[model samples]
Target: MDDGRAVISVLLADDENLIRAALRTMLDLEPDIDVVAEASTGDEALSKARAFTPDIAVLDLQMPVLDGVEVAERLREHLPNCGVVIVTSHGRPGYLKRALSVGARGFLPKTTSASTLADVIRKVAAGGRFVDPEIAAEAISAGDSPLTPREADVLEHAAEGASVEEIARRVSLTPGTTRNYLSSAVSKLGAANRYEACVIARRFGWI
Candidate 1:
């Protein structure tokens, strides 16, 4: 970093090897950027971060062992100086909100252009933040996730076509309690039934 120029050290973590290679290639083209490490899973990413102490970490939202939000939280605790950028195929408003809430410096979709990705890396490395404009707009219109933690768990099980009894067993709650949670979720989503509630919640990326 002290090599006579402002060099941004970066760590790239994605489940896909091709994506990591492409990103590294793109970042290598930037004069002030240096990809310090690469990982294919959240655990590997954390290990690499601990070893390399990169200035910025570009993470894919879906990864083995831990997801991007969890990794970001861990990094916030252990590597506070490393900026986080979450990139995902699902550009859901709720996901974006969660990323920002966990102190991620940037939230971008996988469809982002190479130039934009580099720009965001530089900005975050410099202590600034960025959010995908479309994601932000959707978050503004979608309001907040309506379902509580229990309601969301119930609805997610329902979405997978689980029966009320099965949901109760999985969540360690009685059938009556599970039904109540489902009913609450249905009312909050303004849906006619549990199935409809599941659809609505999934559409909003709440579960």
Candidate 2:
């Protein structure tokens, strides 16, 4: 936890250079916060976090190499003391749940105001958690995902309009088993077909 007198160090990880620059500019203006490192990919973020050991990591939910939730999980395992904050344009219920499950201290949409973001950083640094109220409401109403982990993985592979053979190869399953999984996912999602299932799963961030 931050002691109020000490400046909280922060690491910013976003693929977009302009967004990162804007965040750095805004955060550096605060007296108690310092933007100590910047990374453009999840791999880079993890490397930089290890090198700098920043007090907080502000990560874009979607990034190259790995996503924010994956990075957060890794950080929780390796750098347990560093708090994670995930900011995304896609604030779907499942994404929020995954972020929280991975021990993210803060979750907010990219549209959050600079002042609000700064305050969230301070709060997280003080060993507190923050989730945008609107996002939290949606998460509560949307409820949990019905698909199991393997089903979700199959659906994600199916999302790109891949053939069952291709998806099976990618996921290392037999074409028959892959078909069964897809069928189960489609049935559970109540979709007419795999394509429809993909749409439903994506809307709920299940895949």
Candidate 3:
């Protein structure tokens, strides 16, 4: 427990009540770690951070109000010492890359063991780093070549539920040109469909 002089305070943010409860339980078992506060959304995490002043934040990638990437950015700007650990079910390769880009120090799958979770928390608190093994291997294998800027712009507009015509209108491009860009992006990402392309593009920071 490090003699109680130093305890790693944590702020947990997840959309599900049960998941938050479970994480609290597991972290409580560690004498040197404490759950100082809980939030259900990115906004709540940011709002409560000043009061809690937790040493670490365990956040999910997706949540209402704001997303984890934005939360991590704000934390980096406002709480420089507070480490971020992405705990999510979306184990997509793009997500892992983007999370690291956004200043997250650790990545742990939602399916990771409780012991591993505890270890990651402690390690990050003590200025160590961690990343999910599978994600690490995949990120390495992929070698990080993002789509072109125009392709990223196309994908971002498309991901926002825009139709091809609407995407053209928004991006100030001809409909046929928009379609071509979308098609090229899909091929470059090796995505089976536009939806998959959006996901891949997002992870690669193209959008």
Candidate 4:
């Protein structure tokens, strides 16, 4: 602890070993912070949080088995005292909103400086919220998109040149249903064809 403050224990979760090692090295330099556990996947993070009783759990939003958002939801059920931080390379505008929605008090990007990272950890540990500045700006700029889930799904499949039959099979819908979704997406984007629908969706970070 620094200045007689309580020592803040942290749990680090990321898929990359080198990144974990680097973060540990940097955070260990602080007197009031202690990294109590590390996890390479969402499942491992949830389990370790139970065992370690960390003050904060810093996690990547993208992971195998269970995504970090699901893990955060579960963690809140299991470890109510621990804080949550969502850090990821993908800084999509929707992702920022989703992270906070899942009970994470903070959202950080991979490009964040070491000092800023440490500061976020400290602030979250002290019961404050943190969000990347760029993400905050983009979230407000993009505002709210009117695209629906089915539209986004159809656009993704269309971008890969998936036939309506194939998209229907992949999404558990009928060919007619897939076609309807694609047609609606085309109208929404003011696109002339499936290819143009995909292009505009990508432009707005919808797929």
Candidate 5:
């Protein structure tokens, strides 16, 4: 399939059609890279990844059904050989932290040029890591999150004005436990209430 050159296969997962098209076009022009599959949601991305088994996956950080960080974690568990790169418009410090923790090899903003993305893909495929310098600096300044994972989960569920019972149902926790987590999160952030906690967590990209 290649003139004695090893081509890096890539799976692109972004909900935006235009972005996908542009990326595919850009990557297709590279001699050493091939766009093997594309998906519009996180679930679809996972399914296609399983089917295609691409060498690398370039994922949008905020896909539907499951976020890119969640997808990256699943891929790490199910397809350890496939490297992951997360690109996002958000570029929040907490989001960057979560992506890296999930074993993503590359993290960059959507504003990155196509040539830069190609270089990142090449680097990640070669068992290297890359993170945008500005994002890295912001993450270092943001420090670590104070809330526990459970507490952060509850806060995220509460972000959309969900009641404690609904949050419990979504997270598979008891209503009382959900309330406790929410309270703990609020107290940790010095927020007056659950809503304020959500705002603070979101602003800091903790949720």
Candidate 6:
């Protein structure tokens, strides 16, 4: 706590140990910021956030079990007061767009400055929002995502190198239907194949 206000409690969630350690060290330097808990996976982050009820949850965009957007959605439902900050290397307009759409209060790239990171945390803790300038610019210029929901799902599964049969089984679609979805996604994304389509879509944060 500082200036007679409650200290901003934070939950740090990232898969990388070194990244978490570095963030903890940097955040601990701020007088009004306290990292109350840390998580190595999205599920663990959710559990810790629920248990600690931190003022801010700083999460990596990609994690095991659940991604940052999924965790953010769940957090908004279960702990609306807990602000979410997506800190990721992705930094694509689509990722930023999705995070904001899902009620995340902050979206920052991993390249963000330490001071800027702290400031964003303060802003979110005070009921404000922040988005990386580069991400915002890219998002505005990138316009809308081209893939439909079903196409996006197929592409997302394909990103894992899944066979068409495997994706069909997972999505409860016939193999031929799954192949059609992949073909549609590839054409929409202007890629030569499903693998390329998945790469492009993931890079744009569309999946």
lDDT of model 6 at position 162: 88
Please list the residue runs of candidate 5 whose C-alpha ends up more than 4 Å from where it truly belongs after superposition.
1-4, 147-188, 198-207
Q: How far in Å is the alpha carbon of 196 misplaced in model 2?
A: 1.8
TM-score of decoy 5? 0.78
Tens digits of per-residue lDDT for model 6 on 118-142? 9999999998999988888887876
lDDT of each: 0.87, 0.89, 0.82, 0.81, 0.90, 0.86
Q: Candidate 6 at residue 199, lDDT?
A: 84
lDDT, residue 187, model 5:
96
Error of 4 at 138 (Å): 0.7
Worst 10 residues of 4 by lDDT: 143-152
Prediction 1 TM-score vs. true: 0.76
* RMSD of each candidate relative to the true structure: 5.6, 5.3, 6.8, 5.4, 4.7, 5.1
Worst-scoring 10-residue span by lDDT in model 1: 146-155
Worst 10 residues of 3 by lDDT: 142-151
**What total of clashing residue pairs does each candidate reach?**
0, 0, 0, 0, 0, 0
Structural RMSD, model 2: 5.3
In model 1, which residue pairs have backbone atoms overlapping below 3 Å? none
Note the residue pairs that clash in candidate 5: none
Candidate 2 segments whose C-alpha is farther than 4 A from its true place: 1-4, 147-192, 202-207
TM-score ranking, best first:
2, 5, 6, 1, 4, 3
* TM-score to native of every candidate shown: 0.76, 0.78, 0.72, 0.75, 0.78, 0.77
Off by over 4 Å in 6: 147-184, 187-192, 195-207
Between which residue pairs do clashes occur in model 4? none
Alpha carbon deviation, residue 155, candidate 6 (Å): 6.5
